[model samples]
Target chain A: MSAREISRLVVPNRGQSVWLVLLSASAMAFLAVFALALSVTSAQLARNWSAALAQTATVRISAPPEEIEAQTAIVLEVLRTTPGIAEANVMVAAEQAALLEAWLGPDLPLDALPLPRLIELTETEEGPDRQGLRLRLAAEAPGAVFDDHTRWRRPLAEAAGRLRAFALVSLGLIGGVTAAIVVLASSAALASNGQVIRVLRLVGARDRFIALAFVRRISSRAFIGAAAGTALGMLALRALPEAGGNVHLLSGLGFSGAGWLLPLAIPPLAMVLAWAASMATAFKLLREVT
Target chain B: MIAFEDVAHDYGGGPLFREVSVRLEPGSFHFLTGPSGAGKSTFLKLCYGELLPSFGVVRLMDRDVRTLSRDALAETRERIGVVHQDCQFLDHLSVEQNVGLPLTATGRPLREADLSDLLGWVGLGEQAEALPPTLSGGERQRAALARAIIAAPNVLLADEPTGNLDWEMSQRLMMLMIELNRMGTAVLIATHDLQLIRFAKAQVNARVMRIAGRRLQIAGADL
Candidate 1:
């Protein structure tokens, strides 16, 4: 009865307070995986959606006003007739103006700046043959140049991949740190209860009974800590402002639908770690005194 | 039952006790009287398997003290009850819980009423839930006695069980030990109180042992 009661009294009153352990575990859990969550999802979105951007190429025809319309028509015709080219559309003046406005100042008059004629090409299911398409376009409209967005996409995707890897490494480091802290906490608790153990032995308590008290206490404390940390982590993620180029990537980091329940697992998993570590430490330290 | 065989003990290579041997039988009481630093407590520690003899085999309940595992040692302790001169109580626990410690520790479930009745037997009915630190000297001794017999251990070992108690309280404590011996519990009292030893002999057959120069010897006295 006293053993069971001692288990009840472990964190909140007796040794390391429950709130402190819970808070510490929660902090560790949140920090451990936060970077990983961001990196992995960002990498996934980048890898999965990059093909959509890569499927089609755009042509810009730069020439005099009279020749601009002529070159644009010629580029569109080349794209439509080329093998692996499914569709083509010469950009309307309004679409070109909007695209330019994103880079240039919004107040710039589109008529004042003699912007180039742009033609968008769609690749067939078989995919566009880049060399053939480029040759055809150059022969038809010498002023037309193809842009496949090579320089931008490669670096972006590579950066996303690196971020994911970094996140995973961070998660692993956090786990190691958590284990270290738990080991220290368990050891301290075992030390503090040294006299209690001696008394228990004097009263004829088996080592197993004495060990259970510590294992249960530390485990329950870790569980509480992880739960609070996870809750706060979710809350902080939800409160962040999402207005950037990778808004979808940033916001999409968290679980959705059935995946939302996955985050709830961290507490029990942490408890398991605590139980194992504390149980082992308790028994080992108990071997000396009892 | 305990047997000490040519036991020699040393701390930092300085002898606390050496070449000592004693066999204490069932239903017997031994008073190990000595001045301070005479190894009375050391001899008691050896008897209960709290400390192993450095040179000899000390056996409790027919098992080598040093050979037993932690759990085995715990089970061995179930057959022994030790009360310190200070009556080392877990001050946070109530008087009843303190007395019931041995039972709880050994996983021997005790009924609430029985626990209450045991406290009543010790005449601490009013202080049953009171903390050990708050108990008077006599109450602490009685509580210690209650704890010693709560599991009905075969051997009861006390280091000056009534050193803090007044004369009448000491008499009551001695009477309790004699009663336990009458019921076949081998009781060993380590104290310098000759009066208590003399009082013990009047009720039950007791043997007197003395500690001098780190050795224990049976004394030539009425006890």
Candidate 2:
């Protein structure tokens, strides 16, 4: 047989450490897949929330019932003449009632409640100058209030950003824990296989040869385990409920078309982690020998 | 070749042996005999560079052992074969793999024909597929010998290679060593078996040395 083949076969394959590394890598990879999915999904949500709200505003007019129609007409005229306003239309009674149905209930009494008339505005890509639009509205119509939804957009964007950051942090933690587990498993394997080291050293085996034996075995095990974990994680993600047009955050917690390829990288990354950890541990343990 | 120049070794309490100077030239056969706890095995260890002399320089392959780096020491050891007293083997591996270790461990390709002939020569051809734990005492010693010489080292150091074997088995192992020495490999065997030493001396011109009084003494020709 070849030397490399023999060196690889020297270390006995049966031990507690083998299973320890396999299971730890699998669990870590599984968690990593979740973190990756979260990050990807949150990034999509952040972009969607920011873009959806960025170029839109709403003007709510509150006046006596007799002046409501007059103020609403004046607000529509002012918005039409505005520089960045792309489209402006008064929200219909049914549309207004539908918006309120979530909070109040079905068949909202639009006539009974003294609700203000709401004018929805969609701006061009450049967006209307909110300060100037507000000044014009205050002068033209005393009851007309122009709101660019800046208050709502800022907080939603920040929340999505924080969620993405949290997912990244989780990924880093998973990698660190995987490395630690691999190192511990490697150390235990070396310590328990003292006889193997002695026999190999007695046969004039170099440290590199001996280290590669353990590193190859341990890292390959990690790769196999992580692959299985990643597969299961992808299946779980695919099983999640699909998010249609609804902007619910947790509804679509999985990858879309191209995003499915991202989780495939996790298993190879785990293999690399195991390789580095076990190689370092093996060299350190061999140095302590002769 | 291994040479010791005024080497003294102490295990931190005091000197186990001191003022020892010896040289094992190529093709020379030497038997080291001493009672238990007389530092015979320690002397063998020094010869193979497993332990450094505390008070003197020990050289292997014409270089100071202390100056050689860890990897360099391993490379030096590839040229010197050692059969430990306990007949250590990787118990998980079969006898054939254990015998082929010196060549394979050193990154040298092992030929099947050569390994088969060597195993047959050592009377272990039938036990090649067996594990170390399943082998008899004599078989283990033979396997250890086969592993030590698989790389064709310049020198072979055996510490009690025949310590646990019967008279016939000991003679058989000694004859193998004698044959290897005839092939120009220096042989050094450390044991308390005087009869084995006498037997080896009859077959070949061998020098017998005794370790006593914390020193190495060349025995007279009476035995």
Candidate 3:
């Protein structure tokens, strides 16, 4: 049958199950948007952290105040001579003081506190061998410790990866729940309109024709609901207070540039899901009726 | 054409009818009469592929109903129109849409002129906009008839087509069936109305068959 004609066969207000489907679709879309944003942001954070920290190391020189400058020079010399170390520079005293000011009060006298000297090292792509660097530092500057940031970077990167995994899993669960709701609602609609289906079949309506009527109705509803939910989700994300300068995770939790198009895909995906669920339900019910 | 070869059906409550065989040829008119619960509806269902024969074969247009795929069966059904006693309809649709349902179902574009003509033919021209729930029993029956013939099927099966109509309406409906038969459309009407059978016998060359004793037999010299 023509879609228009077949559509007219179902009473528009016959069942409330469609509302259940709409509600479920909207809820799923809302959750899915957030999940998608979380996953994308977490992945970006992990990538940034890995890239920024993977080829760098730090050298801390703690010695008697009289020997600090000499040890710092020794650490720099060792790093510059290393095969994979690209550059090494001692941090300025003011920079070291600023780093310690957060722990001590800003008014403290920095130079009198016997602060350790810090050296920043930039390594080549094939970075320095940590064991060799540590042995060299221990002999030449007994107080020097070589830290490649693995202890800190590993945990932060792992945490971001876990968050990304969790968000993806949430998205999958939301999709599954949406599909389940659509199937249940479609089955209820089929049962409620059992007589309509029977009449259509009696008039020689093919299964495709009957299923088209239902699939179109359901999928359209899902699309509308998902579109609304996605819009609201985007707005909610927009309304969040701007992240503070250091809160990279919060700043990365929403889309930018082409990433805005990702949420738009949710509505169409919802329609496809609803279409499949409704078609399967209609054909199965029609089979049972016959 | 519909043919039954020793067809039998059971509802798991033991067989309702067994070893029943019949064939409906093109341009033929048949009256199936039987007592209540004697499998008249069951027989019609088997003829239309709504129910499969438990022990034998029922074929529509030379294809065994059992072997026809769901789509094939649907295609076959488009050529065979059926009218139930209940005059089932999508209650939300207007009478006009219900009457033109066959064409709609077959994906044929509905012609306003043809629908007007068919409704006028069934005496429902004025009631075309009425919903099924608002229709009288006789009006419903005429609408059902109009729906059954909208596609101009090769075979028309009506189960108690005039069961809910007055005598005059019943006669009017029967005349329409006879006209369809004369136009080379095979007709099958299952009814217990002896008077309607008598009325039909006088207007057309029709065979009256009775379902009794778990068998189908042509009643000789009955009317």
Candidate 4:
């Protein structure tokens, strides 16, 4: 029969099972969209954190008040002669006080505290070897210590990677649950419409024809439900707080630019999943009953 | 198109019928008469490949029913139409769609002119748009008959086709079957209504078989 005619043979199924499939698919798709967004956002955060923290180091010199300026000059001279060092500048006393303002209260007595002098270093694309730079600093300036910030960068990147992994796992679980729900609904539809099936079989309908009849109905429902859920999810993400400098993880959990197109694939994927689940379920039931 | 060779069905209990051999030739008409629970329905089911025999073989369209795959069995059934006791139908579909299902379900085009003529032949022209649930007993029976012969099957098997209709309706349906038989389609009607059988025998060459004591026997001239 023509596809249009085959679709016209849609059995009148129970309303409860229909709603079960639609609601479950919608709920699962909504969750999947959120997981997708979180995965994308966390990946972006990880890249940003790694890129900003890499190729930078700090030099701290602890010496007598009279010798602090001389050591700073020596460190700058050594850094300029280094092959991969792009620039080196000693941090002013005011910049050091602002860095400590978050931990120590504002307006601290910097001169009385005898704080260490700090020098900031920016490296070229091919950064200086850490061991070579440390050796040279120690020989030229005895009290100078080179800190490359690897200890701080590793932990932040690891956390973002874990978050992205968790989000991906969540998306997989949602897909599995959606497929299970569709299978249950298909079984219920086939079981409840026994009379319709008998009539169709009596008229010489192949199992394939009967299976297609139910598959089309179920997959279309899943597609529509997933579409609506995806739309709602995108809207919810759009309403979230915007990402900016110093944004926390949860505050900026959304997609930007071309990333919005990713969630649109969810509805089609859900439709294909529902089709496969319902087709398998229908054929199984037809075989058992026959 | 259907042949039974020493067929027997057990159905988990003792055998309902055994050693029944018969063949439905082209352009032949048959009536099966027996008491309640005498395996009349089972015999009809076996004709359409619905049930496999326990002891012997049943062949449809010259192919063994046991060896045919599910798809092959369905293809065999397309050449053999059947009407049930309750006249099953897809309640969601209209009377016309249900009538034309044999053609449409098999991927054949259902010509509107032929469907209208067939519906009118069965006297259901006015109720073409109605649903099966709204149809009366006689209308349902006529609709079922229309669906059966819509594909122009080689053999037509019916079980208790007129059990719920009045005498006039039964005779009307019997006439349609006789006309179909005249057009070279084999007809088999399983019913305990002996009067209907006698009525059919007068107009066409119909053989009457009775299931008694778990065996099929040709009835004598008692009727």
lDDT score, residue A106, model 2? 88
**Tens digit of per-residue lDDT, candidate 3, span B1-223:** 7998988889888788888888999999999999999999999998888999998989999999989998899888889889999989988888988887777766888888999999999899999999999999988998998998898899999998888789998999899999999999999999999999999999999999899988888888566
Give lDDT per model, in order.
0.78, 0.90, 0.87, 0.90
Give candidate 1's whole-model lDDT.
Answer: 0.78
List model 1's recovered fraction of native interface contacts, to 2 decimals: 0.57
With a 3 Å backbone cut-off (N, CA, C), the pairs that clash in candidate 3 are none
A164-228 in candidate 3: lDDT tens per residue? 99999999899889988999988888888778778878888888888888888889889989998
Q: Which has the better DockQ: candidate 1, or candidate 4? A: 4
In terms of docking quality, model 4 is: medium
Model 1 stretches with alpha carbons more than 4 Å out: A6-12, A15-22, A29-87, A107-151, A242-260
Instruction: Report fnat in order of the candidates.
Output: 0.57, 0.82, 0.66, 0.66
TM-score of 2: 0.96
Q: Tens digit of lDDT per residue, candidate 2, span B44-97?
A: 888877788998889999999999888899899999999876988989889999
TM-score chain B for all models: 0.95, 0.98, 0.97, 0.98
Task: Give a tens-digit lDDT track for model 1, residues A171-282.
Answer: 7776667676777787887787766666777778787877886678878889888888888877776666653444366556654456546567778888888788778877
**Distance from true position, residue A208, model 3, in Å?**
1.8
lDDT, candidate 1, B124-193, per-residue tens: 9999989887888899888888887898889999998888889999998888888878889998999999
> TM-scores, in order shown?
0.85, 0.96, 0.94, 0.97
